[model samples]
Target chain A: MAINKNSNGYIIIYTVVMVVIVGALLAFLATSLKGKQDANVLNEQKVSIMKAFGEADANFDGVVTMGRINGGEFTVVEKADQQAVFELLGNRKALGEATDNLPIFQMEKDGVVKYVLPIVGKGLWGDIWGYVSLQQTEDNIIITGIVMDHAGETPGLGAEIATAKVQDMFAGKALYDATGAFAVRMQKGGAKNEHQVDAITGGTKTCDGVNAMLETSIGKYESFLRGAEAEVEADTAAAEECTCGECCEEEIVEPINEEE
Target chain B: MKLSKNFTNPLAANNPVIVQILGICSALAVTVKLEPALVMGLSVTFVTAFSNLVMSLLRNGLPSRIRIIVQLVVIATLVIVVDQFLRAYMYDVSKQLSVYVGLIITNCIVMGRVEAFALGNKPWDSFVDGVANGLGYAFILVLVAFFREFFGSGSLLGFKILGDWYTPNALMLFPPMALIIIGCIIWVHRSINKDLQEK
Candidate 1:
């Protein structure tokens, strides 16, 4: 007796066989490639963050925790990225709210400690995020650089925000103005000052997204920034104040010869 | 020579994309870059050939009521496997192709061949037809991508073909431009095939 190919039983059996085969194939392939894919993703994150910080080749010593801007300012919840590091970027879930623990990337260059924070926000289509490094010298703190990327944005339009030229606009821009407000803005038409960067011309929604993302995400770390600045200032002042009366005597040693 | 028409007809006169105008969505999407277009073309060609083969083999057993469902399942599985393979091996190209690779399951070329030629034909004949249709689609996809990437991006694949003085046309990069380019190809094809013209 020949099997009936068009019977309901045959079709049902065929469907089950096909689904199981495809599912098994997909699962096996995905599982096998998961390690490589995760490595690729992790490498990409490192490259992008480093590029954003204007130091693509800078050796990432390791992840470091920045003391809260005011030692209890906002909580930066760890475990954000399944890694025990400072990827302190706020998303839709943590927006306008304090994070449990904000992760700051610390890099020591030329005796100065540079702090890089994570940025995460919503774009027109999907998630937009990047790393922004803050450089503090003897006096003030400024954005050393920023690098942003998006999961999905219109190519050549909204996606232009991820280009080197766009990210370069954030370098050396002050994190806050005289009023101590996080003042970085993606100004449409043209940006007039250091705190502003021109928005992508036909990519208004994405630019608006970057603007709000930076504003609020950076705003969430406001106290931390202020606290870091004050700490630096106090450090500089304390070293220069010379307030001890007991050891006021100065030693008059001969100046060392130069170029010996 | 007599058997060649099955493999050659779709290249021009019986083309799946231009003459029949069936699978235009994927054509518009993956044709923006030459590399992706090539990848997509290969992907389509592979899926069409394999799906056609599988459909022909199962055509006798398939219930008439659920033939379309069977065809879809075959095409979808083939496309997903291809997508996964691409992600694993061609990671960069996979990233660029993104959703368009998954969208291949919707490309009418695969299903169109199964419905038109595969069901009643021998596996070998159906495979030939599938390859021909796949080539036909690839032909149009490459042509569209050639013009789109060259004019729109001033480059082919990743190499710069045009001088810096040549400013790329932003419009050509748009999805509508793919349609326009396809329209132009159709116009040219029709001009050569006067029989295709309407009275």
Candidate 2:
């Protein structure tokens, strides 16, 4: 076979044609898979939140439903009075925005309304975010669930932080002391108290990062919490009628002020 | 046409990594984990075979002056197709493979086979040659990964093949081990096949 000595123009044309063909093909494939990719990400978020809350049968399949939280919707209630509903927040994608106007869920079960605050922070290799439901008093809080993910961390070490055993330790752990200061810490050696979490053996840096993240991330919500508490107090004082035992006791002494 | 010489030559005698010293970077990076190594090997095999076939088909029409450019364009196109297929169907594996999948474009074995064999041979022969060379590359990778994953983490493809008593050596997962293993493989392969010795 005689080898054809082709001109430079022919080579350039061939290269351009090949580039266009391949580029077009890849573009089509990427467009087709974009939906599936987004769904996978959403599913992963749900699975992380469920795992953090120690919920059973949490599959990372990205179908949104009322029963499943999936980082999309969540119910918040006050710790003081579990019966009161504070708020119901939906469409959580807006919660991660830079705006100060957070999507807060409020509901009234008994009489008090509580504020549900969402927190986001960075883990060792990726992002770790969670939602903390606080009572109107802003004293006691419950970690509804946490979602942790990593871009690329050492598997079995840093990645293990996403597992159930590590995340479950934060379920009822109080973020503040009686003095109302952030005292939440991950115990490096081992957790001595119920509030402390045991660190993974080889994930010391990751553990410390989680601790620092929670502190800084949760600290931002302090103002919103204080505002909610103040609202609750004002509501109680403004009520004309009181059906509670304390209010009934005050009713009996109403005539004594007139004699004085 | 005799098939034995074409098939066996690449497996050991003209092994790409040891003898030809091509495509060593991926062998080191992906070998740390068996799963990724397997995926990378399969991907290389697919890319090499098809690229060679395509190159062989166009060899007659390909201008001598731009042959190298044409070969690269063909190989790169195949690599992109493989990458897209992996991403679409096997998203998790694709993520784990990461940039290594894209790096397939630079893997020397594909380009070398195209220039050396595909450009000069018929399409059928080029395809076979591509497969043989890809298998040869994969053979070395699997061997290196077997030892690396076995001793590095006391696991095979993430399964605990070795019991708890066998303490894993962390150094095995490092890239240096791949170099040493490839060197040892070369030493053993050369010792057994005296004809492969450099003049």
Candidate 3:
């Protein structure tokens, strides 16, 4: 039983059959794994947000409150509506010119409250995005932590932004200088002030992208930040005034009671 | 005894990386860190072994004219499957490996083995040969990665091994360092093996 192995008909049929089988197998695997893969991405987003808050292991649901800021009005999203925050952040760039209504996550730890802001921007190669958490102090806002990730930056050069050593420089840096300008940036050469951090040596374009991203992304929430700041100051002032008045009244009442 | 030779020969005598010079591209690219190198090794092993076995099983089919094309389709399918699985279960490593995982489709070792051995061999024997050659390539990758991570970053598998005072050799972090290390390994390998040296 001898059949020509190199016949055109046989080759064509073999190619078609092989292509069909392989295509079917790959499609089936991709569809079945889509759920698990998407879950992984969602969990990674949560972890990045948590990392930006400096509580890498903390539970996301228990510690954070989600909100959105639009036209200086803040709307809190309930626990069930948390997916809205992620969706908005994912669509931050798509909203482009209409950058309002950006998502914000609030968490308090060790009596200090911080706001986690999702930032998106373009690098030299592709989209670069991350979570940046700013801590509220008595006078100014300081960066508590940051977690950056890139889509496609040159490895060991522009991609260094994802490394902790680079991200650590942003911590404790003030968003605005004493004059109240949005001064935080990745300074070229070397950083000499509190508002600036050293830019990646070889990643100038990517660093520039980061600088612009920080300014623009953080700028979108300026009104919300100011409003929150004022509220905190008023609350503290009221508490101080109450303590002072209570002390004076207690002393006066005590002396009157003694005379009686 | 012949079955065992198919498994053991590529581990040293017919080493795919140092001897056959196959898959040197990925060997150089992913060996910057020990973790990725190890993962890359395991990944290549999976692709090669499966492709070899599959090709060998199909070798008897009457289609010599399109065997190369068939081999390519099989290898590509396996690589994609590996990439998808990595993205699903090991997202971090997947990100770290980045484009190298996809590039595994082009690694010459998979096709070389399928063409050179698998086409004329039994399925189980071809599979063993594929695994052996894969480990051979991985052995060199891990070796290069060890020196690179140890000296370039003062770390092993992401754990810092050197003290703060120990400044790392920045040269080792670059790609050229991997080549130099490979050269050194080849030199050492030839010195011991003796038979690998040219006349």
Q: Which candidate is the best by lDDT?
A: 3
> DockQ, per-model, please?
0.47, 0.32, 0.53
Off by over 4 Å in 3: A1-8, A79-81, A87-98, A123-126, A152-158, A201-206, A226-260
lDDT of 1 by residue, B1-199 (tens): 3459889899899899999998999887777779988998999999999999999998777778788987988898889888877877787778777788888888888888999889999898899888889989998999999998899878898688999899988788788989998999999999999999999
Off by over 4 Å in 1: A58-98, A137-140, A239-260, B1-3, B161-164
Ranking by DockQ: 3, 1, 2
Candidate no. 2 TM-score: 0.68
At residue A157, give the lDDT of candidate 3: 65
TM-score of 1: 0.83
DockQ of 3: 0.53
Sort order, TM-score high to low: 3, 1, 2
Question: In terms of DockQ, which candidate is strongest?
Answer: 3
At residue B109, candidate 3 shows an lDDT of 94
Give the least accurate 10-residue stretch of model 2 chain A, judged by summed lDDT.
A81-90
Best prediction by TM-score? 3
Off by over 4 Å in 2: A1-5, A59-147, A154-260, B64-68
DockQ computed for model 1 against the true two-chain complex using alpha carbons: 0.47
RMSD of candidate 2 to true structure, Å: 8.8
